[model samples]
Target: MGAAVSDTSTRTTPEHEASRTPSPPGGRSRLAALGRAVARRRLLVLLLTLVVVAIAAALGGDVAQRLSSGGFTDPKSESSKAERFLADRFKSGVPNLVLVARAPGSVDAPSASAAGRELTERVAKAPGVLSAGSYWTMPGAAPLRSRDGRSALVLVRLGGSEDDFRATAKRLVPKVGGRQGVLDVSVTGSAQVSVEIEKRSEEDLAKAEAITAPATLLILLVVFGSAVAAALPLAVGLLSVLGTFLVLRLLSAVTSVSVFSTNITTALGLGLAIDYSLFVVTRYREELASGRDVTEAIAQTVRTAGRTVLFSSVTVALSLAGLLVFPLYFLRSFAYAGMAVVALAAVGAVVVLPALLALLGRRIDAWNINRALRRLVPHRRERGPATEESGFWHWLATAVMRRPVLFALAVVAVLVTLGLPFIRASFGITDDRELPASAPAHVAAQALRDDFDSGESSALSVVLPETDADAGRVGSFAARMSALPGVFRVDAATGSYVNGRQVAQPGPAAVRFRAPGATWMSVVPSVEPYSDAGTRLVQRLRGAPGAPGTVLVGGQAALLVDTRDALAAGLPWTGLIIAGTTLVLLFLFTGSLLIPLKAVVFNLLSLSATFGAMVYVFQDGHLQWLVGDFTVTGLLDISMPVLMFCVAFGLSMDYEVFLLSRIREVYMETGDNTRAVALGLERTGRLVSAAALLFATVMAAFATSGLTLLKLLGVGLALAVIMDATVVRGLLVPAVMRLAGRANWWAPKPLRRLHERLGLKEA
Candidate 1:
């Protein structure tokens, strides 16, 4: 031991000696020191902020191209597998273009038929179309023409995934969809609808941002009572948004980012930057109001409010990171966008905003736009912590404390009742219904479903493992499928069979079903697509007894089944990961296990109410007139609610962190649980509501978008945030903490020891 110690002593050098010395203090201590340093070098910090914004602007322009349009299903599922086989072997892809050709009188009239056939021939020879066929050419095909005979359909299969197909489809639209001989033409299908959804979403994202910006600026002006103070958070929001785009651009080089992620990136970045900046700026002004000098106030504010922003951001980021457990890129991409936004927003609040504060000094309140408004309330100063004016929050807290059990029971009842709609939620993939009724794709799809006995888009394609000389087994499989309760008909290379009756011999319609080593069968549905009956038929087809491993199902119905199962399978584990980490993080912040657990329960209650309202309004069509052109599918898309839960949970916990941190701060200083809860409620109550209102407003603007799914996200999140601020934070939190008493800070002795050694706190 003596020799080893002597050798170690000899090996230590100047750099090693410095590295081995006691590490600098961390958390609030380190932040306090850094805040002082930044105050001393305010100009340098300002320049650094400018540099970050400039670099982000340079890189962010190309981010749109990197994001993809589709990621709603598991790529490894049976549906995807079947599509792969069909595409590769059959030289077949899902029909990506549809032409709804209409005539003045009747489709079979000489003038209309000549025009329709001419359009079909021209489309068949179009650059991207591998094949095109219409009711004009296919005699006696009832499914190809409308019941009234005034309109007929033309289906085209387009291969290759690039601008070639979209560009070609657009060109065909003007030529074929316009006047073609005596008929009028309109086009919609898989590719055209996908294009429209992308275009509309991009426009909506821009519109949401446009509305949010001026509104956020105006709200901030009122909150801070001065243009200069208000501009600080807005500045942070802009920088954070640009920075998030650059981060996404970098991520794109490694993986395909979804365009949907961009919408989230902007929305969350704007809200969170304002939130963190509001907290910090509020604290800084408080220190100044108490007569601290500029440097002291900036340092103190960073130490406390800055620290709170750090923890709040961590909790939010971790909540999103839990989404990484799912296999879908759509969920994982959100994790990417969310974490980047939170990190950038937090950094701007702590580093850049503080430096600006030090430079501005008393000028932080320059350009007082609300001077007249301020006169309405005497003794008005923009203090960070609450004053005598916060009596409302204090009085409410006292009332809740007096009857904690009753308040808790009442809140729980409302939350539970609200979540009842989710019990029967029907999960479907996004379709024409996601678009507004005015969308051409939506109109065309509606016409097709209404007029035709069977729309090809809804037909389930079943692929057999082998293309057989054994025509006997092929006929047998077709017989078995056609006899099922919901099967409209089964068409295959063997023949065309309807309800177990041979309607037609093998013909041109069955040509696409033949391929080397694999043959496919199309099972048309008698029930409404995406309904429970349709899903059951898909399940039965997949479970067809004779060929356990030989069959694969692909279609809209199959896609939903696979997607629903995939989401369901990952959900429990996702919940566990999020809940577990949230518990740990909150415990580290508050040094109390019970407090973290209470937070989770309360968050769920608030989210349940939001979900309940979603069902009542969007799913049940209760407020149809409020949001125009809503076509209620009597169900929700599978992805939207999951996406909402992930985003809303993080945001809800953001408020939770703010409320709990304030309460814990007071409790630590005073050592009186009741006084702590009251004081904490008093301080954070107005701030939480203001922040919630601003964020909810940003979300509500998105609800104005034309799409049903976009409307669902907007309304659901806005309602959730409002509920958290008013009901959960104001009433439920205080009531529960009052009931829990000192137990709110309790921990196991071992955990208490661990927290003592390594725990976080606001200054």
Candidate 2:
């Protein structure tokens, strides 16, 4: 123990030691004191942890059932208002359930017509169906018939929330779908698509768990060289996941939470648990190797690595907080789950993990596998931990520092080039194409696309709940809407219109379009519902003159437009929240204005490259073989990039904090900027690399999902972590720091005083 202190003292100059602020009177940092307390109560802490895990297990078993399958739309947008008006006034909204019935021959086959009417009547009279209409029931409804003249449409509006409608679809599809007498029937709609996505997501979650757990454990064994040491991280990971499930389950009771959040909870909880525990365990082992007593080693490990873990967790949680500013509950759910799981993982690492280690003492390294492995392969022995001036990472840092400008420019150019494709990114909502071709809902939706002349189910619904215009004026409005570009036809209370002319007079179907004091028009578009042209058509409809009353346009394209507008409005606040909190936290940790600013900017750069890759692969459909086959929509899902930015930016800052914490400690100890950078990279480079690898593995498992949205998220995050860990952390950070020199740690005088009072430092 004395020799260890002597070695540390010898490594630092007297001037550097004198320049450092002294600790409080007891000379024990709060984390160190907490570590001692934990050591004293190790048994009790483990027992309490077991009890909590047990409770979490009991309460979280039904979490999957409770999570909703939809939250993509902005509930406060005009589209939402339009939907509400339709539902409140007419007891119906857009059709979210469709059944296609196909005939064997043309000329309106008698058997197919009877089967289609029977199917529509059966569904319309069903318990959850709000309204139903078909080609056979609605007069002069040519749009309901396929262009090929084999299949006709049966559109039904299921009345409820997304979850309720999805549940109704699940109950109704299997009963009415498939062969109906002489006709072939298939059921699909937005609700059914969401149901299928939820099912696939659950399956993918299980598959991801199966792939990540054993693989992560194996990697942990190789990294730690001890089965006992490797198992500790897995245990903490499991605890964190269970705790997050409970948190999500509880949150789901009072507010909307997306089912997909379960996957994130598992991936992030396990990955961060492994990251934080690995750092703590590695530092503890190093302290033990220095001949310190078990208690003292535990205290020192908590004081340093534990503090870093806490800081890293906070940075991650704060970055995730940016998602809350968005109106979409889908993104907000991730924010909730992410923040909760990060906090739990941090607690598990710093509190529970330390207690477990304290109890184990030297047994933490029991059941060593490195010796046996080395004996089997003499050339493949595990290396010892590197010293300050040594190791491959140290060499790379020195090399990059030697020509900082050249290296910086080269790396930045590569990153910017990779990011160039994002300049042309096209954004749209997730649709049936998000599902794999093998999915039944995808097959049904594809049939609609291939057979139908226009998207009737995705028609823009122009609702006028209090229109006072006469029937002739209403007919004029419908005629004008039909003449607009992209509009195939318009159905109103007065009649059906095509190309500025009324083609059909009031019929049985026209009654549904009117009430005592209100009316609505269905403007069916010729363009794809999720296409840019579809969005433009919606904007044009909203701007069209000669409306009878207050007009609110709603439909799939309108929903997309409103959602994009909502995201655009919230994006600045989200940026401010993420960047501002990151600056404050990093400043508190490093007391350096430049480092925090650099971290925020670099994270954005790395994320830009990731977004570019997402566009090139998922949007442009260049790497279908890599991420598995998916429909090429020519536009990325609008909500995914925002979610990815929050998650990937958080993770990028996670690595940043890990590296900066070590660098700051070394800088404080030696006051040599260049030496500190080199030593810090030597100490933490392997740790960050290992953590990123494990996290990337977890995210890669998500890329195997059949859903393209999940695949985009998984592939994007994995790419971001790898790029951040390697290109950003390994190359760019050292080069930039070397160029900055002493200014890397600079702050204004007032801010320096503030940092001195509030900054985090360990004894």
List the candidates' TM-scores in order: 0.92, 0.96
Query: What is candidate 1's TM-score against the reference?
Result: 0.92
Error of 2 at 530 (Å): 2.0
Deviation of model 1 at 29, angstroms: 2.5
* Candidate 1 Cα lDDT to native: 0.80
RMSD of 1: 8.4
- Candidate 1 residue 574 Cα shift, in angstroms, is 1.2
Could you give candidate 2's per-residue lDDT for residues 1-763 as a string of tens digits?
A: 1121112232444333432555342424678899888988999999999999999999997798899989999999999898878777776777888888888875288877887788788988998888899998886854788888888899988876777888899899989888888778887889889989999999999998898878888899988889999989888888899999999999998999999899899889888998898899989999999999988899999988998899899999999999999999999999999999999999999899999999899998798998777778758455877465657888888888877899999999989999999999998887788898978888988898888878877878998878842545788988999999999999887888999999988788777787777888888899977778989999899999998777899999999999999999999999999999999998877778899999988998898899999999988899788877888889998999899999999999888988887787777876777777887888889888999999999999988899988888888999999999999998999989988877788777788767667777654
Q: Name the candidate that leads on lDDT.
A: 2
lDDT of 1 by residue, 192-264 (tens): 7766777788899889889887888788888888999988887788788899999999987887567788888
lDDT of 2: 0.86
Off by over 4 Å in 2: 1-19, 23-28, 379-386, 468-472
